[model samples]
Target: MQIQDLLKRTDKLPNVPDVVRELIQLLNDPNAKYSDIAARVSHDQTISLKVLRIVNSAYFGLARKISSIDEATVLLGMDRLKTLVIASGFASSVTKVDGIDLPEFWTESFRVAELSQWFAKRTESVDADEAFTIGIVHNIGRLLLHLTAPDVAHDIQTRVSNRQASRFKAEQDLLGFTSQDAGKALMDMWHFPKALGFAVQQHKRPFADGDPDPLACVLNLACYLNACIRTEREIDLVREGLPMAVIEAAGLSPSIVYELDDAMAVSDGLGHLIH
Candidate 1:
């Protein structure tokens, strides 16, 4: 089916729960006061508990434990707090998708998100938090595909495994569209920033021509590198699409890309925070 058809099907798609959606809107609003956000978060006892648990986890490496949501907000800072809230909230919703194993997907997704944030910080392309958030949400399309068309998603996974084809190509061949297409459509339906939607859409094809957004290029490279390491599949087709201009724009090098694998090894401790 075409992406437009998928867009029309979004009403049937799973969404962030109402409370979580309101929290996201509040967090995204520039003029939102902390007291209002805190109150909203407080209203959801389960979510608040998860957020506190994550904050106190090894990821933050806090000198002392954070015992309350208010303390977490104070310690994590607004940017990190918002990221944790969004990540935790989304994780709860997305983990429930049937026919897909959540643990494996979470491992790869969290690794990509961590790596993307590291690259963004190293290259100074954007705030590390913003890059991390983008990295976490970038593949949300794949989750949607699994929800809407599990059979097609299985076919795509098989093609990716057996043929070593790029995820984008596998999805296109099997379903007449790609995760990026579906992801962009979902982002649009949710009224996400156009830049973020574009990043998700074009992440697999960074140098597709036009005014290239540097942030998208960063995420594109991060996703490419993550897939290269995690999947046994050879990805020459995916590699060839990485443009020299885009790499230059991000101020990254082959050496840096090679080092990312080792850097990720050190980040294993941070994975516990996402639980």
Candidate 2:
């Protein structure tokens, strides 16, 4: 459960393939050409098929069916196409864990992604697709923990269920680190953008002064809203001190937040989109 243990387990960490990594890099580039991006996506037939499937799925709400990677790129745009690829890669990669139920994990991930997209669209601070990707991968540290230290992962889950401790608090007590910390470390090593790495690292403590990036604040709000929807428990100390300043900055209200959660829960055919 120590940071050193996680560092040692890096070799065993699930990684996106080289092609997928290249695709991600292209997506992250601001000036990457559409034809070049399409070419990269089309090279991997499996990923190309998945891209087409997601584009035609309810998640995109496209008026026409997408039969090719080029058409999908045209319909979804570069950023959204990138997000879908990232989500598809992760979803396909983490289908099973020794101690984790894949379905339950994906259910929560889908909900979080949907809610994050909703909030992002409402706020306009970041793209909804980017928010969806962030929400889906925000807890990837938990997936990594299950692989590296199954016992510790079980202990953390038990505390969340029995003691009602927040997942972050539980991780801190049991593992001397939280999932956000682990996720940040892992993504940083993977060469993710600094803004995303910072968001994953500080999502639980969004309001702490001098956190320069506002995307972290948006991620924190998304996590809070996800937790609120999944559990009926009243807002505790952890929920109360979140960056309302950031929430206001994002142009969101408590009511709009609740509506987003509701819409995510009933997003038609969304259950089929995860796997």
lDDT of each: 0.70, 0.70
TM-score of every model versus the real structure: 0.81, 0.81
* Per-residue error (Å), model 2, residue 144: 0.7
Instruction: Give every collision pair in model 2.
Output: none
Question: Taking the tens digit of each residue's C-alpha lDDT, what string does model 1 give over 36-117?
Answer: 6777777778778888887777667899988877777777767676767766766776546665677667667777777778
lDDT of 2 by residue, 65-126 (tens): 87988888887787777766776677777556876787767767766776677677776567
Off by over 4 Å in 1: 7-12, 18-32, 231-244, 251-262, 266-275
